[model samples]
Target: MNLLHANDQAGAYPPSYYAATRTPLAEFPALQGQIQADVCIVGGGYTGLSAALHLAEKGYDVVLLEAHKLAFGASGRNGGQVGSGQRQDQDWIEKALGREVAHKLWDLAEESKALVKNLIQNHQIPVTFHPGIAHACWTDVQVRDSHVYAEKLHRDYGYTHLETLDRVAIQNLIGSKVYKGGEIDRDAGHLHPLNYALGLAAAAAKAGTRLHERSEVIRIDHGATPVVHTATGKVVAKQLILACNGYLGNLAPNVAAKVMPINNFILATEPLGDRAKDILSQPIAVADTKFVVNYWRLSEDNRLLFGGGESYGYRFPDIIKTTSKPMLEVYPQLKGTKIDYAWGGTLAITMNRMPCFTRPYPNTLSASGYSGHGVAMATLAGKILAEATAAQSERFDLMASLPQQRFPGGAALRWPLLVLAMTWYGMRDRLGI
Candidate 1:
């Protein structure tokens, strides 16, 4: 089943809390007939939108096509945390790809966060960057490791925005007794994800990008001049960018080989009012240390927006049931709190949990498999795509040079294999091992 149409209606955003509270953008017309541009971007999420904005600002004739509404995928539905580093931490990156590459990647990650902030500030996007993300740990070993990692980031990377938190401190901050200890990254933060995407789309459009909603890319004729075909229209462009992420479908099988799509769910509780302080005292986001990580933060109106639960399938499970169990496990005080909205989204993940950046064809560039750390990286990926299209490819080449491996099984069997692996990992999480 095509994940774009598997669980949601055609040309409609999911019934997510983000959708309910989104700062609406006037819809762009769907593509018709044929068009030509310097760059054709597929998937109108963070990467594509950001790419369009940067490319258009650089005076490139850009056209962006979305299967549905902009930010209709994981970009809009995620936990909204602008995380500090890449999906994998520095130690893992250093061990896998040397210290120099790790340091460069660290600098790029820092630039990504700065880019997001700059975009919001420059465009005056109707979103607030609430700073601070707590790394809530369930085990003492994990807490120790987290503290050590925080120190490494400071000592080696010159990042000193992290504050160590013991069990008592964590419990007091998050109002949760489940966590043993952790650390808070004051540099990292959260925001209204969908609004941010909409702001990017608006900025891109204003920069002279031709954006087409409901313009799902069905095929691509790759060569010197790539042709992106939608159902009713096509874009012939000098360069093509595939930023589709999890909803990529079979557009490019080479990318599909390395990036596996998975389903995740999130729910928003009714406004907590005074009880909001009981949930999070300082309005910071919290992500726990679990194999299938649980992340949450408060909405502007004080509702708990918690995200968890994962399934390696096209169809979504009962989101409220799937997500509420984990949320309650972390904060049982919200046992009977009314769940105002529940929704599921598809996000791509790679074998090593690092993003997969590839040049599927000489004229085509693709970036996906952010593995849940896309809020900032995906935005940066767009800017990099713009730079590469503009003949400045140093950063793009560096990201593409990162070690990316295909799934153990090919696309046909990868889902089943992931299911088995995730089942085992989930069991271990329950067993606290």
Candidate 2:
């Protein structure tokens, strides 16, 4: 019943396949008194931590505050799929912002993936980086469009890597007949998101970023220099970057309005073992081309980590079974597969499916709303913000140029609007519309 403490996810990470098998030693302290830094970042997820690491590497004294532990939010509890591109496709993206800017943005998505790869390798973060991710579709036309997307991406953008899979090829690859077909992006891949966050936090700390756990930012006073006031202490920073994403809350009404939070739920099945072959043809992340995307990938121990559906409120929807029913439709034999763990995390989406990157005040900046594609994008966003702070502002300027609007209602009424929108999408999923 606490206004802020989401207790449901406390034991939420209990000895899950992720906790038991992966993750390294965690080491961040709680703030005891007032402190100051060059940059004070809010939110301990990928965006904040990534920025902390970049700034720390630049030897700028940095301090990062997290309401909960690092990765305790959406970053920790995601589907673990590192998807390519922005929320929308390059075609739509180009159409939205014209061809030239779209080309630069699409190029950034590719760079985002490489940035993650380089960070993991440089830090030696022991995360599983496998090749290939496929999008499953229900009809032939959808399959054709998937192929055409790949062809057009290559033909127009000089970008090539997406391979089209036919119905038979998809069946052979997915071990599921539910999908008519889809496309596989060999360059795009998956990883343990929580583990990755933790790894970045460790590296950030090692590189001299002061990470304060359980230090919740209550308010911010913006000016030529900025200050972040927390429960027990405050940070007097020369500049600020709000990387909190969907959880931005009342920190900045403008940010909260432009970025609407939606809950995304994920479930891990009991170890599939021999039955693992019954799902993925190869050990790769799989996403279905549905309005509510069904994204699934295997864990280190071979458990199927499946995620889909959205709830438009603060409460994690009581609909994991409802959202995952379609997985049964795809692989019917696994009816009693025993969901070892099920939980939901919140992710933000923008009206245009574009991220919001801007300065709310003179020295206080905010960047969020990559939607579900935060793993790599958020990390890259951190770097962009750091570069902007360093005075090389082109990247940040390009990102800031993307137009995004807040939900019609404020946070209080935003939920109802989301409820209405999601209800329509849920109905579509049910009706196959």
Candidate 3:
């Protein structure tokens, strides 16, 4: 479905607390006539804005186009979990790539955490970035796996930021006995997502970047200097960055084929004052060890932001209960918490559970396939894409070198295959297998 209309069709961004608390800002004019820039970005989410901000800061004339307003995609409506690492675990990555490259990716992952903080500090984006994140396990075996993974990261990559909190510790943290045990990383945190998106857009404009909202790119013609065409006008540019991601639609065919758009949703509960402490010993964003992961965090005002259910199709789930029910399983203490607002966003996932950065055409860059781990990595992708545009293509090349497999069932069949796979995974999660 057209995500924006789908969102608003269901009263997506109702008078939620975030909307009430969001920063006031000016809107940019949509693309209307022919123009030129050093680079043109086709989406206004994190990756696109990051590229525009960085490139414009470097004195390159940059223009970014978004079919809807800024923060209209997953960038604004996600769980706000600014997590570390790829969607795949370190062991999974090491097995797919090599030890050395895996270590480098680990380094980048750590850098990704720092990069978010750096941007917030540099741009003064006040998004209530929470302190750290925790991973809870439903079973003893999952807890053991968490321990093993924690040890592996420290031993192999010399990274030691997380503390393995046992069942008792988990009990103390979340004030819950639902989880067997877990690990907590003070580095990975959650934030006010919409505020961050808006802040980044403001910074990009300040850096001499031109941003146009409700401006969709219909066609892109490639050459030494590419030309991007909208309905009423066109932009002839030195380079093109296709950061549309899940919103790419048919702008690039292979992109949609390899990176299928999946819907993950979030719900906000009425603010709880002292009762919020009853939910956790310490506040932190959380995801479980289950395949159909249950992720939750707290808003600055103490409202619980929970996200769990996922759909492979274009449409958002019709039932809000279907999405927030997972929250009860994770923290039964929240059983009585009143759910206020529930919204959905489309995020692209590659088959291999890894991001893909490739040049579909020379000078025409395509960076998508972030799976569910986009917050930090997408921002990093933008900088690397800008680097490539500036002739420093090594980092971007490293990301592009990571093995990417086409979605299992081609374009038409991929969604069905994903839904099938997710059903099995969801069943496993339900059975606690």
Most lDDT-accurate candidate? 1
Off by over 4 Å in 2: 1-4, 7-16, 310-312
Arranged by TM-score with the best first, the candidates are 1, 2, 3
Q: lDDT of each model, Cα atoms only?
A: 0.93, 0.82, 0.82
| Distance from true location, Cα of 212 in model 2, Å | 0.7
TM-score of each candidate? 0.99, 0.96, 0.95
- Residue-level lDDT of model 1, residues 1-433, one tens digit each, is 7888989999999999999999978999999999999899999999999999999999999999999999999999999999999989999999999999999999999999999999999998999999999999999999999999989999999999999999999999999899999999999999999999999999999999999999988889999999999899899999999999999888999899899889899999999999999899998999999999999999999999999986656788889998999999999999999999999999999989988888999699999999999999999999998898898999999999988888987767788888999999999999999
Whole-model lDDT, model 2: 0.82
Q: Which 10-residue span in candidate 2 carries the lowest summed lDDT?
A: 7-16
Clashing residue pairs found in predicted model 2: none
- Residue lDDT tens for model 3, 1-433: 5544655533234344556678987888889888998899989888999999999988899999887777677787777788878788888887888888888888888887788889999998866677789999999998999999989878877768889989999988876678999899887998887788888999999999999987767788878988898877889888899998888877788667777787877778898888888776577888888787788877778888888875656766653676767777666777777878877777788879788898887678879878888888888888888999999998899999987778776766777877898998888887889
